[model samples]
Target: MKIMVGLGNPGKQYEHTRHNVGFDVIEELSRRFNIPLDQSKLKGLYGIGFYKGEKVLLLKPLTYMNLSGESIRAVMDYYDIGLEDLLVIYDDLDLPVGKIRLRQKGSAGGHNGIKSTVAHLGTQAFNRIRIGIDRPQNGMSVPDYVLGKFHKEEQLQIQDVVQKSADACEACLERPFIQVMNDFNQ
Candidate 1:
């Protein structure tokens, strides 16, 4: 089975913030596949379904961004999911807005959610999908920048990017990670 976890804070206040793009991607996938993320367990809301003949568990962690690993770890333990079968989606400040990157394994690069995930998982070797939120400029703190909502123009672009990210994720279930990377990492 494949487990896809999206990292974000849980609440209306954090909704639509740049940091919540992970949640946005998961929601988009939920809509695209009719996954119905209505089951609550392991500090997350998840839905299990078949995508392209592969069993998939779609999760939106409710532990918020900073402690997202707790939710992921719990579900992994219960489901016996290994690192290779796990893919985490989250926002990246290193890339420009509306861009997306697929990495087989890497450091968190200052993402608290990824940091916590690495800590709990005891390794940095796992699949990750990073949706760029762009870095803050003009003296804006990183936290403020990530937690802030997107501008109107950015919102439009991000909507399209989120849909693309969702498409990339679905493709992941049907092909090799490297192939998916080659297809979407442009």
Candidate 2:
């Protein structure tokens, strides 16, 4: 089984913020694959789906961003899956918006969610799909930009990027992490 965990805060208020792109990707996959992530347990709302004949666990952690690892560790242990079988998705501010970087293993790059996950998992090695949320121009603060919603034009661009990220995730289930990193990282 493959575990795909998306990191973000839960609840209505954080719904459309740039930080919630991870949740958005999971939602997109849920809607597209008929996964019906109606169950809530292990500190998350998730479901199982078959992608390329592989059983994949689609997770949106409800423990919020900083404590996301608790949810991830719980699910992974329950399924007896190794860290290598895990795929994480989250927003990134370092890259330009509308781009994604697939990494087989790497540091968190100051992402609290990823940092927490790595700490709990006890390793820096894990597959990740980073959806670029873009750094603010003109010296705008990082927190303000991440917590904010996208502009009208950005909304369309981000939606398209999210869909493409989902496709890349699907491809990961059918291919090796090295292959995915080489093909999807940019």
Candidate 3:
């Protein structure tokens, strides 16, 4: 089985923020695959379904962003999923908006959610799909920037990225992580 986790704070206020892009991707995936996120457990909302004939568990961490690892660890333990079967999706300020980068394993690169995940998982070896939200403007704090909503133009682009990210997740279910990275990391 494979588990794809989308990290973000849980609340209506954060629904449209840049930091919630991960959640957006998960919602897109759910919509595309007909997976219903109807269960709340492990401090998250999750649904199990088939994607490309493989069992896929779609998870949205409800423990918020920084403590995402807690919910992820719980899900991993409960399902007995290994590192290789786990894929995390989140927003990245380092990449340009509407772009995505996939990595088989790497450091968190200063993402708090990734930091918590690495700490709980005890390794940096896991699949990740990073949706770029672009860096904050000069003089804007990182927190404020991440928590801010996108402009109308940016939102249009983000909608495209969300769909592409969902396609990437589907590719991961059918192909190896490395191949998925090579195919989607453009």
Output the number of the lDDT-best candidate. Answer: 1
Clashes of 2: 0
Task: Give lDDT per model, in order.
Answer: 0.93, 0.89, 0.92
Pairs that collide, model 1: none
Model 2 Cα displacement at 54 (Å)? 0.9
**Model 2 residue 51 distance off true place after TM-score fit, in angstroms:** 2.4
- The candidates, ranked best first by TM-score, are 1, 3, 2
lDDT of candidate 3 at residue 48, scale 0 to 100? 93
Q: How does model 2 score by TM-score?
A: 0.95
Candidate 3 wrong stretches, greater than 4 Å: none
Candidates in order, TM-scores: namely 0.98, 0.95, 0.97
Error of 2 at 179 (Å): 1.3
> For candidate 3, lDDT tens digit of each residue in 1-186?
899999999999999799999998888888888899999988999999987688989999998899999999999999999998999999998999999999888899999999999999999999999999999888899999999999888978998899899989988888788998988875
Local accuracy of candidate 1 as per-residue lDDT tens digits, 1-186? 999998999999999899999999999888888899999989999999987788899999999898999999999999999899999999999999989999999999999999999999999999999999998989999999999999988988899899989999999988899999999986
How many pairs of residues collide in each model? 0, 0, 0
Local lDDT at 62 for model 3: 96
What ranges in model 1 sit over 4 Å off? none
lDDT of 2 by residue, 1-186 (tens): 888888999999899799999999999888877788987999989999786688888999999899999999998988788888998999999978899998877898999999999999999888899998889888889888888898888998899999989988888877788887888764
Better of 1 and 2 by lDDT: 1
